[model samples]
Target: MPYTRPARPPPEEASLQGSELAHEIVDVLVDRQAEDVVLLDMTSLSVFADYFVIATVDNPRQARAVVDAVEAHVLADGRSRPKVEGAADSSWILVDLGEGIFVHVFTEDSRAFYNLEGLWNRAQEVVRVQ
Candidate 1:
């Protein structure tokens, strides 16, 4: 599937409202040794999503694992399952959690090419997980 940028949230709204769930998702990524976990504040950028979580996994297997972790975390927390994309190929998996969008398990080359951080330059860097 092509890369579709999600809708941005309102500027005045607080993206961190889902901080607890975000932390849980970040924890899962970190535990799996995902790289460069970045939280992008998309409040002023667009009106669709609040935050964007980006990270990289080493390989296909790890990609799937990361997706599983995110799915498990959100479901366990009583939140709905994110609208997942790109899981079959395990190259770039995007978990759309409504208020937040999580991009997991990308290869180094893919991550570098997409450069989500650079693309959303206007977004404030909320946190960086190792």
Candidate 2:
């Protein structure tokens, strides 16, 4: 229950007991209407985080909805509020759910431009929600 960061994929999603939090985040992203929601398992690939929940948003409003929904769900589940990176209008946003869980939210163009999936191509793709 104390923050223990996962050691692989992720940017700003919680690490509440590791994979459990990552999966929980995936659910939240889907519930909020995120597109191309992907849960990347970086346990064997990265060093900074354990899991990455990358999602695509349509606009700033959709981005806010995704981030807000993630925060609300995590808090309601008894974890502290996660740290969020980027402005409300940012093309890309990161939610740091401390301890190695990261959530990356980006606009379609931004998602394509950054190409995290391409960068971490070696990381195992765990759960992908449409």
Candidate 3:
């Protein structure tokens, strides 16, 4: 069967469970042993997404596992599937979950270089899973 992407709901029509969904994502990452998981509330800071989840893994294999686990959990929980970008081997991988959720997986060096935390410092830090 041909696959179809879910249409992004309007802001007013956005899922009310965005925060819960974000927590669910964090849970998945923690279960997968992701390091330094950070959740940022971007509701006021950005128009592109409402929440950003960042996590670091030591190697490409761990990165891949974290990505896969997150994807599986989101899908199984009845949320819209994200459009994944970048390969597992890449230093960074982004998963865009429409209706204001984005997941970023990066290597330690890549995380430092990009410094998403610093860039989004204005966004309130909701959770930091160490």
Candidate 4:
């Protein structure tokens, strides 16, 4: 199948109600056994997203699992499904949780090459799951 972007929420849905949602996302990543899971507070750093949940997985299969887990939790939380990218290759899947969160599930090498955390050094690291 060709790469398809997940449905994006309306623009007005930018501000998530509770602050704990990001942590909930972190929990999902941890539960999926994602490695080096890091939640970065990007509110002050970027208007693009309030939080960036970056996770490193061992391979493409693990990446897909992490993405599925995240989408499930976000949906159960009453949030719109995110506009996802990179799922076809499953090397680096980005789950954009419309307002409050943006998740990045990357293969180990891809994560290192992108160095997302390094680029957003201004954002504070809120959660780190082994």
Off by over 4 Å in 4: 1-18
Q: Which stretches of candidate 1 lie over 4 Å from their true place?
A: 1-16
Per-prediction TM-score: 0.81, 0.85, 0.87, 0.83
| lDDT tens per residue, model 1, 6-97 | 67556434344566566667778888789889877676787776677888878877888888888887788776777888856667878888
Ranking of candidates on TM-score, top first: 3, 2, 4, 1
Error of model 4, residue 24, in angstroms: 0.4
- Candidate order by lDDT, decreasing, is 2, 3, 4, 1
The models' CA-based lDDT, in order, is 0.75, 0.88, 0.88, 0.82
Q: Residue-wise lDDT of candidate 4 within 5-62, one digit each (tens)?
A: 8776455453454247788888888999998999888878786788888989889888
Candidate achieving the largest TM-score: 3
- Residues 1-130, candidate 3: write the lDDT tens digits: 9999778666555645788888889989989999999999999878788999999999888988899988898788776687899886888999887758999999999999999999999999999989
